[model samples]
Each structure stands twice: as C-alpha cells, then as structure tokens.
Target: MKFSPHAWAKLIYLRDRGTTEVGGFGITDPGQPRFVKDIVLVSQSCTEITVAFDDTAVADFFDDQIDAGRHPEQFARIWIHTHPGRSAEPSGVDHETFARVFGNCDWAVMFILARNGATYAELKRTGNPHSEPLSVGIDFRDEFAGSNQAVWEGEYLRCVQAAPMPPIWDLDLLPGDEPYLSEQWPWLPI
Candidate 1:
C-alpha cells in the first residue's frame, strides 16, 4: 500500500521532530525509550491503512484523533515507529505486538529511522509473520532547492512524489485499563 501525499508529509514532519530526541516522542528514560503502535492512514485511494505504534506518543496521538472524530471505522491499524539503533525490520517486540493486535486489522506499516537520518518504511499484511521493506526513492525536479524533493516507492517510481509520516487511528479505550501500548516501550517477547 502506498502512502498519500498528506500522509508522507506527516511522516516527514514527525521524523524531523524525532531527530531531536534520542529515541523520539520525548521519552528520556534510559530503560524506557519511546516507541509507536496502532497507526492508521485513511486515504481515498487503495486500502485505508492503520499504523500501530510500539511507541506511546504515537498511540496517544491516535487516541487524540479518535477523540476528535477523525477516524470512524478504524478498519485497519498499521504498526509504526522508529528504531534508534536498529533497522526498520520488526523486532521481537514488534512480533509480539503484531501477534496480539494483528487479529484486529488487515495491514501494518512500519517506519524505521536511524540516528544519522537514514530511514525506511514497511507495509505488512495481517497474519503475515514478516514485514516487507518499502523502497523509498526521491525525485527532485529542482536541484537547487531540496524542499521540492518527492519520495516514491522505489519499485514503482512513477506512482507519486511523497514521504512517510506517523498516522493516528480512532480506537475505543477498553474499560479499567491504561493503554497497553505506551510511549515507554516495555520490552515484550515476540
């Protein structure tokens, strides 16, 4: 599934913000770094994808959006967020999170960014034990201004010009529970 222009903009915006913080989303605890989970992108074309954050702020953002009535169906949830020292591939924590949440949705999107600015995005289908890397290709019509650069799927370059961003979903809160997916990433078995 390809991301829309608007969604790409949001991902870039969040990436910029994440660049400043050690792990992203402002969690400074050494043992409790930030992560994202349960994200959704409702696009007019293709499948409306949901991104699940292994990180807390990402999840909270979705909750806020839902409270604001942005996403009504909450059809699919994509799991996304950054990996500070690792690649964008799903970790053990990611596997466990997917196992627990995969039953609720049809797709998953994962965004991994290194500390030095290298980034990668992945889209996964439910019940699929693996996450596929999304090849990102950038197109620049004007060489002088880097702002005009457009990102596209490397495999399908002509599709569009865009980037990736964090998405929020409208999910209902279960009773008597704090959000299981929190900003502080509690390491769980895959």
Candidate 2:
C-alpha cells in the first residue's frame, strides 16, 4: 500500500528511537509484539497505519496526535514497536494482551521489526479470534546488497504456522530466480 507522508514520518520517528525491543497494547492485542512503522487517521477514523518505535512515550504521543484534532475521526490510536534480537512473532504475553484489548475496535494494525533488517506490518480484523493474514507489500532497495535488492522486495502475508527463529532466512545462494535457501520469510525482500 502507498503510505502518506505522515506514515513515513512515523517510521523514521520509530527508527530514531533506536531501541532494541519495543511493543504496544490498546483495545486490541496489547501484549502481541508489533513492530510499528507508521500510522494515519483520517477525520478520526482509523484507516491508515505506518510504523513507529516501541516506547512508553508512545501512549502520550498518540494521545497528543489525536488531541490535535487534525483528522476526520474524533478519536484514533496507532501502535508501533521494535524487535532488536528476536523474531517478530507474538510472544505469550502478546497473545494475552491481544485477547484482552481487541474488543475495543473493529480493526487494528500491528507492525514487527525484524532485528536491524526489515519490518513487517499486519492489518488485524477484529471479531473472530482466528483470522487470515492481510498481505502488505513494500519497496526497499540497498545498493550494498547487490541484485538481491529487488529480489527482497515484494508482498508479505501473515504466516499461519508457529513463529520461526531469527536470521529468518539463510543468505547462502546459487545463481537462480528461486532462493537457494530452504526456508524464507514470505514478506522478506527477494
């Protein structure tokens, strides 16, 4: 999805916080780990979401953003966070929090930072305890990584299986369109 400038700013803001680990809790999935990148509220309605840092300061920041009354919705909340050394999977704590807070709204967004590398975002559909993964596509390219840069850019959907460990993919490869690595993050850059 194309993000607004506000969303981009939020992502940069989170990165600037420079935390090794970050998370959030709200009406929904409080404990679930979210690697926030950016967020957007149009006229008080929660329609757009970006990324941001995981810090205690976020609650106040959100409140202030909403209080400014710049959007279409009367009230809005956006949550973001970081994952320094661990994978983006929701921990046990996250599961409990999600179960508790999710009742507050019709929808919520969750973002997960992958160590120092990439970020993952999920648009959660409230109501059903179990739901399908919403796919989000991002474009990211670093000249230092060689041709693999474009390969790493594409669509990512929520994984239904158990969360995997870090270094989510093996970097080793042979010359081919398909990744030589046996397992890979569906959302990771090709």
Candidate 3:
C-alpha cells in the first residue's frame, strides 16, 4: 500500500519514539482508500507486546471524523501499527485481533512498521478470511505535507498510555473468575 510522505514519516517517528507498540487508523483519500494520506490515533493502553485501543476513544474518533465530512471508508479501513522489534511479522494476537475486529468490514488493511525498518501489510475483505499480502511504500509523487513534530508529539502524548506487562501473579484471579485479558483486549476472543 502507498502512504503519503507525511504519513510515512509520522509512522516512522511514532515507531521510534517509544519502546512499546503504538497503533492508529489510517486516513486515506476518499477516491483511493489504499493510498493513505494521514494517520489518526485514539487513546490506547500499550505494553511491550500489546496495544489495546479504548472503545470510547474509538467512538469519539468516528464522531469527529463524520463531523468533518469524511466517510468511514476513508478513516476506518486501514489499521496501522508499529512493532517494537525487528520483525514486522504479525503475532498470534495480531492475527486474532485483526480477524475478530475487521472481519465484518467489506475491506480493510493491516499495516505494520518495525523498529529495524522492516514492514508488512495485508488486505482483508469480506468472504476472504485469508489476507492478501501487500507491498508497503512511501508515495513521494504526491504533494505531501511536511512533518509537524510538535503536533505529532502532542497526539502521541495524549493518546498513548504506555504500561508495563502485568505479572501473572499480579492478576490474582481464581479459577472461576472471568478472564481479565478479554476485558483489556476486547477484540480478542476469550
């Protein structure tokens, strides 16, 4: 998939700015949903290996985007995230979350950017549970906006809540207790 230069730079900056994973939705051109023009982050809690987006924050993002006259296809179809490690390969959690969360949509894209500059992208569509691999690249041909570090930093600070992975003992759950993980990562199956 093609990303505008500004969006590509922003994703790289966000990826390098932290040791934990960070995720956001891609804003694409209305006419060309595969061509991402920007990235919009929602409030989320992050550990080294996981990123849990806040449901309320996602709702607010939808409302704000609609108010601005953008369609859902423009703002919600592409999921962009960073992998803090060298491999951009999707982990089991990533696969499960992608399937459960974006499965119902007519089409969607999941893109991963890694710290070591590796990347992975795939497109999923209704009726096709199997994802089609996509090439990732920056589209410099577009008249892209320059990076705005201050704004990006502000957004990162406002939306990303980095947290340590809770130890197993710290969970303190009895056998019959509801799975706490399902709550923190609502998109994952219990």
Candidate 4:
C-alpha cells in the first residue's frame, strides 16, 4: 500500500479540503516497494463515509491505459478511498467489499485515508478469504516541487467541488439481475 510522493501529495491535498474521493491504479510489478502509477481519481460527495467508483470510472481507467498501449490485465489492481473524520482503519464493510470485489486477484490492497493524514492500509491475498488483513505503512516521500504542488492543490479543490455521483451498483438489485460474487468486480473470473 506504499504510495508515491506524488500520489501522497495529491491525496493529502484532497484530505485538507474535505474531499472524499475513490482512487485506484495499476501496479508495475508483483513484489516489494509496490510503486502504483497512473492513478485515476474519481469524485465523491461530502456525505460519504465509504467512497465507491462507478463502472465508467473503472472502464475509463483501463480504456485510457489500453489506448496508450498497455494491456488492462498486465497490471495488478489496488483500490483506495477516503474515510473522513474516522480512523483510517478499514471498517467491516470495507473488508467485505474488498474481499468480495477483489477476491480473484492474486493479491490486492485496500487503503483508507483520513483527515489527519493518518492512514490504514491492508494487503490481502485472495487465497485466505477470511485472513486478517496485514496492515502496511505508506511511504510518502517529499517530492513535490512548487509547480506540481499548485496543480495538486487545484485538483483537490476541484474534487471537493465536483458533482456527486451515485454508486455504480444498486444495493438492492433484483435477484437475477444481481451480479454473482465473482462478477461484482470486472477483472475476475466467475
């Protein structure tokens, strides 16, 4: 769950402005120092305790990467969201959502960001569905220069102002219309 300085900076900016955003990106490799790149940010509402992403956001992220010549399946996925005014620790719902949606990946990471910059991150391997989440530390390096700082700040503000969108999946989908557990997320086999 280690984040690049640029990613951390952008996340910190969002936290300071009281924005709740859902973020995810593809990882470059399978092990160590797990550098996440090309993070795509999704806007959220002020009242949200758990930020969620729409299918369009997920599709667009992969679409852009594919257009740039990268295969969507080539990257491991990590999903993140802000938990404002709460402990950065993952909630029960967080654990369930992470396990259910990302269960098919070889491994996946769920990160929670809080207002004070306190964070709780967990890395899970799908093999042990009920295993306790391994808490991980974030490596937020100080790499923001003046220009990039300003840009990150502006994006944060824009995030706060962005129109709120509803969650992509309806909690009460009609029985047969409901996606199977494996189908809840796109990158997995049913």
TM-score, per-candidate, Cα-based: 0.38, 0.43, 0.87, 0.64
Tens digit per residue, CA lDDT, model 4, 1-190:
4566656666666555554444445344334435653345544334344455556656766676678776444343577666554356665566777778888877777776767566766777756755445444545464543326666656454444433533545323211111322233333232
Model 3 alpha-carbon drift over 4 Å, by segment: 166-190
- lDDT, candidates in the order shown: 0.36, 0.35, 0.83, 0.54
For candidate 3, which ten residues in a row score worst on lDDT?
Answer: 171-180
- Per-model clash counts, in order, read 27, 34, 0, 0
Backbone clash pairs in model 3 (N, Cα, C under 3 Å; residues 3+ apart or in different chains), count: 0
- TM-score (C-alpha) between model 4 and the true structure: 0.64
Candidate 2 has its poorest 10 consecutive residues by lDDT at 152-161
Which residue pairs collide, candidate 3?
A: none
Clashes of 2: 34
Candidate 3: tens digits of C-alpha lDDT, residues 1-190? 8988999889988888888889999998779989988998999998756788999999999999999999999999899888776667776677778878888899999898878888889999888867799998788985777789999999999999999875654333211113333433444334
Candidate 3 residue 122 C-alpha distance from true site, Å = 0.8
**In candidate 1, what are the lDDT values of residues 1-190, reduced to their tens digit?**
3333433444454434322211222111122111221223221111111133334544665576667664422322443344433234444444555557554556554455443445656656667767676665332232322232233122112211133322232222211112222322233211
Clashes of 4: 0
lDDT of 2: 0.35
Better of 2 and 3 by lDDT: 3
| TM-score of candidate 2 versus the correct structure, residues matched by position | 0.43
Best by TM-score: 3
Q: Which runs in model 2 stand beyond 4 Å of their true positions?
A: 1-13, 16-19, 23-63, 70-77, 138-190
